[model samples]
Target: MTTVTTNKSEPGTTTSSGADLHLQNISKRFVDFTAVDDLTLTVPSGTFFALLGPSGCGKTTTLRMIAGLEQPTSGSISIGGQDVTKLPSFQRQVNTVFQSYALFPHMSVLDNVAFGLKRKRVKDTLQRAKAALAMVELEHMASRKPTQLSGGQQQRVALARALVNRPAVLLLDEPLGALDMKLRRQMQVELKSIQTEVGLTFIHVTHDQEEAMTMADTVAVMNKGKIEQMGAPRDLYELPKTAFVANFLGKSNLMYGTVLEDLGDAVAVDASGHRLVMPKNRAVAHSGAAVVGVRPEKMRVMTLEAEYSPSANMLTGTVLDASFTGVSTEYLVDVPGIGTLATFSQNMGQAPAQRGETVRMTWEPEFSFGLDGNEKATEGKDAL
Candidate 1:
């Protein structure tokens, strides 16, 4: 049963700059396929939150549900303190900016911004539109059609339109997907600046890890219709809780091993008779075949004779490939029993190891993490 309620904001009325958005066990299904499953998240007021995942993940579906473009299959959504689960798009205090500019080619920039206000029959539409234009720094383009403006300018116009209403929540669904790489980066900075200036709740849905890390105050990493993990960008990168997050958000070199001892603060593991140590909290299970994870940049590779710390975890491998990309050198090493591993070393005036050379790798035990060897990061991210 569905009930429709008229919860519209009064004409010419804009809510406060921000309001908390809450979702309780939200799910979306299409026939036999499930897009989102039992997802619950709380986005604080005046925050920049990002939902990040791959193409088939439920990030976009979650955003559409918030915008009322798609209804949830179960559960309720609330903004501030009111239940908005059954409300229509116009009845909710939120607006969305899509990847497509969806601008009117024949309409002037000023008129485009004014259209929403005019529909609501608000007083002084022209004045408010100019104010919004000025906020986006496009006031001078008021008389020009959208066709005459550059891609970035047109994007700014769309942002101005959505923001002029002062909706408590501004939903951005890949708003920078249409811009070139350079412009996309530029817009990322601009958008964050604008969101901070307005103090509105911004929920941005995207698949780009770097973009989310660059702009979002908090990031929720999604995978296979569920949230894999959520945290600050640095936390997710440095201390991932799942193999999926470890691989998807950035690069990780995982080595499978069996647990030998569980120290109070760290766990000892044996990978093909070579002992390794990792922080205890990172172990998903108490014992058994576990996986040890280390970021490529954390492990150091040296010639067989170079002196390295004897207390740290060490492994030897034959360099399968080596490539230098100016700032850093990447190496692919093949160990006798632990499979292939990738490592990166910064080029601080030191020569890189050549391919086919025997090298020893060492890293601090604290930098290594223990994970469930059975978990597959490749799941759901590949072709069906």
Candidate 2:
């Protein structure tokens, strides 16, 4: 393995091996519309990084540019410290697995996996193809045709086909979109394991948030042709930097609030005339109008007669709706002035609130997150 030495690439700086993919100021335009706008990202070598966003958010375009399928209108792409922005698809050290799989219907799985190796006139095609199939745990099906295999098996074959080339980076553009939910989930784990075992950089483009969060070592949330935020899955989910990310990544109970005081350590907030408190460091904007968000599971429910704690943030509301999921009961509550707020209470043997019933929602002050007031929570609606 090549040691990662400190070196300045373009648009950003990082210490990584040549297998890392770097895109600096990359953009793509179609006439009056731009698909990717000044995008810059660095995927560390051998990491499972996911470009996550809704459809038409330029994730696919970015992957295409990296794979040399789509040329960027500006900027540069470097792999293993070599410039490949001007290179054709076949010339680049990258492999792509499309949603369609594109396997040869007439060929056996072993031949399908070795197709690229044969084209390149590589030696020991059969030997290498079997090795690749074993990586994806599909070695037993090498003799089967594409039509004879299940969707998951065929997807594994597609993966095997790409891996046989042993490219520096493998780009997967919704490669599991065709599988059923259960199988997609199973493949997500399998794909991540295979990438880790081979120590190959994998850049996955997907609209599925769960799949991305589940498999990606690092996730970049794309919005409107730009990266809204990027970090580890847990960090991005627990502390979203923008309203769009708060909503797009997961469910967020966004409530409009006014800052009452910024006391260095903690800030006092008032939402719907109900008092609230959040850490000052968590305040996106202090001493002004803001939108404070909390994850549903962070909140707890209490009876109207229960005494409130000054240290906890509390809201008074009427239960407008409730649905009992297996592990938790999701509730929609209507606070007088702040609108509807969602809460998820664990099913530790507690009855759900009924419609029109008055209730109180409480959560620790540390769990509340502040967002920019001017930006609507639906800022990511542009994605499909």
Candidate 3:
């Protein structure tokens, strides 16, 4: 059963054309498992918010709840200050573009985009659908059937179909998951541009770290049915509060250490008997044990005899292996007691380090981040 309710704005909150989505204390349980646990968030109007996590991390469940596909076991959902907790999916001012384009194979691209508007008895359905197609740069493909279009084009059709309704909030459930790597990257750019042009609240659920970081203004990293961290992509990438965020978002080399001293603007840590310093503001731990982390790309790798800044944190290691990954060379270095660490050095026509060759790794203290001592160093190392 579906119920229609008038839009109601919350006191002291102004309603905008692009609705601000609020998920308060939301929880969802399925028989033996909890999918979403007490998740609370507020996506600002017209913002591109990404729920990023690996599969089974509750990101999809959360999106399903927001789109009215699943009713929360507890808590409330509101958009533009109007409570839609009990409303059916169709009754809410929301539209979704799923991984599976879900276009009508028998219908032309234009008709597929216009289907929803035609059903709603919306005026000038053709004109509105054409406008939506143009938004995705797919207006010229309107006469073709979905079977005749490329995966990328079909994905755009799905986007146009959902967008034509002019929903207050647009839900993108891995909308680019089906496209190839190159096409996915292209679509990511197009999607962000479309979102900017329309200025609508876009709640994108994606497992691709680069996709989330590239497109979202804000990304909430979820784990085990809860959000581990939420912030801007750069913030989350550079200063992750947890080991999971560090390893899952990008390649991070973590070294377990004990806090030796607290210096107002810096913290000293003893790792494998070697002293290291990290910016105090970046340290999640100032006392006891700490996990010092630096992204692979942040560390510079050179021969052991190379001159390095005296203030930089340095480690001597033997090269375990090296891989040329097009733009950069990735080196796996074995630093005795500290275990293996990875470093990425740009390919500037320099000789690649050889296996078993002694090397030195150094990075500025400011680039180092700290995580709580107890966080498992391998927490999200292999996530997805």
Q: Candidate 1 residues 172-232, lDDT tens each?
A: 9999999999999999999988987888889999988999999987888888788888877
Best by the TM-score measure? 3
What are the lDDT figures for the candidates, one per model?
Answer: 0.86, 0.86, 0.90
Order the candidates by TM-score, highest first: 3, 2, 1
Superior by TM-score: candidate 2 or candidate 3: 3
- TM-scores, in order shown? 0.93, 0.94, 0.95
What stretches of model 2 exceed 4 Å from their correct place? 1-18, 381-383
The candidate maximizing lDDT is 3
Worst-scoring 10-residue span by lDDT in model 1 = 1-10
Task: Rank candidates, lDDT, best first.
Answer: 3, 1, 2
Over all chains combined, what TM-score does candidate 1 have? 0.93
Runs in model 3 with CA error above 4 Å?
A: 1-16
